[model samples]
Target: MSGAAAAAPVRRLAVIGCGLMGGSFARALRARGLLQQAVGVARSAEARARAVALGVVDEATDDPAAAARGADVVLLAVPVAATEATLRALAPALADDALLMDVGSTKADVVAAARAALDAARLARFVPAHPIAGKEKAGVEHACAELYRGAQVIVTPLPETAADAQRRAQALWEAVGARVRTMTPQAHDAALAAVSHLPHLLAFAAVHALAQQPDGARFLELAGPGFRDFTRIAASDPDVWRDILHANAAEVRAQAAAFRAALDAFEAALAEPARLRLLIDEASRVRRAWAPAGAPPSP
Candidate 1:
């Protein structure tokens, strides 16, 4: 989207932690003929084998550094908690001119980690990106080349980030059919915390609360489409969510507190029939109007 000329297709793409996000990225890039070779890294041998078998990568390994050795682009797709350690491991093996980016949910902590782990020269090539796309599913087995198509990808570049690196990152996402947007890391984190993280936390809490009731199993048997839709995210990988929630704790907490206040207001309105109806109507109205213009629900 920038006026700059397009860079050459990536010769070797190294993906660290090749799960749903990373595997989907490799699949998408390959589908567009933008990637020549893909190397995937995962902590588990079974995962590595699965990635290779699924054609997500040409080769797989447990060492991030090894996978990154000759890469033209390195995509960090590990959990938020594992990002720093992975970056530190790859730092010494990274090529001087290789582009670096990530798909982490939170950006501030990742930017901080890059600052601490990478030298100034290498840091310049690192761009922080978060793709606003995924399913409740996890694992490379569930990856799809079209996952990022028509999705929004947010690139949060630091003040010191190199212009070329930022441009390349945006271009790559665009080539993969993602709409790119740029913002500061702080703003990105705050916005995601409110829209993404808080809703996930609420879903997890709701499911947990329901499971604790004496008639929990019976209640679950009677759950309808509304319950299934609302709690869909509660089934997301807990380890991944744990890292994201912890990394963005402050903003998540603030959003959670705000949500609690709203819930309390609803509870207080229970004694007033008219007020309760008004509250429900207000919430329904807001939700109905919140969908992006021209965006349709996924089939």
Candidate 2:
């Protein structure tokens, strides 16, 4: 929704989490020669080592602040729950002109974290971003340079965000081969709750419901492609999803209420043949007409 002039290569890039999202970003930018140096920080020494060993980043460290120090750009790619603590650690070390952004799944909570953790100047440098791209499998080992190619990235700039930071945020994502869409933090959370968060919740719940059955194992043995496709996201990292679901709990709850109402309508329609056909037809039309951004339409 917003546009910025192209940014030249940066001096340094620092990533706080150095996991799937963070490592992938580093790889993407490195492929483009966008930074003179790229550093990564993570709690797991093994992961940090893997990042450097895989050349996802030029260097690695355990201290987030140490990695952030002197960096021209910083990406907080940790879990949404760890956002505040990570920001607190990095803020003191962040250079005044440096731009900071996050790859968080949710924006409202991350914006709240930024407000609580950073001073006015530091907050001004912070840009909240969510790249709508990932694989079901997550880890530094799975990081790829092409992961964000053609994906849509949501940029939610706060009122306090500096013009330079916003511009850089837009440029950074575009450089990584992602299309950018700007949204207010509240709007981002509300809309994502209905489309993304609610679907993940349903996938997780459906799998749990299936596994809880006495014939769960037997049922699984006979499962087909439809079951596999529907529950694929249930295989997502539990801890990561837990943090996301909790961080956006209020929005997710509101969306869930709407989902229940939809379910109620479906149930009522099931009792009437004509109404059932109408409901199915409407849903089919909507689904067939829609496709993920950058995706080819269904045949």
Return the top candidate by TM-score: 1
Candidate 2 colliding pairs, count:
0
The residue ranges of model 2 lying beyond 4 angstroms of the native Cα positions read 1-5, 295-299
RMSD in Å for model 1: 1.8
What TM-score does prediction 1 earn? 0.96
Worst 10 residues of 1 by lDDT: 1-10
Query: Which ranges of candidate 1 are over 4 A from the true structure?
Result: 1-7, 293-296
lDDT of 2 by residue, 1-299 (tens): 12213757878999889889988988888787776899999788888888899988889999988999999999999889999999998889999888999998999999999999999988999989999888788889999887887788999999999998898888888887889899998899898888888999999999999899999989999999989888888889887889899989999999999989989999998889999899889999998888898732322
Error of 2 at 289 (Å): 0.2
TM-score of each: 0.96, 0.95
For model 1, residues 147-224, the per-residue Cα lDDT tens digits are 887778999987778998888888888777778889999999999999999999999999999999999999999999
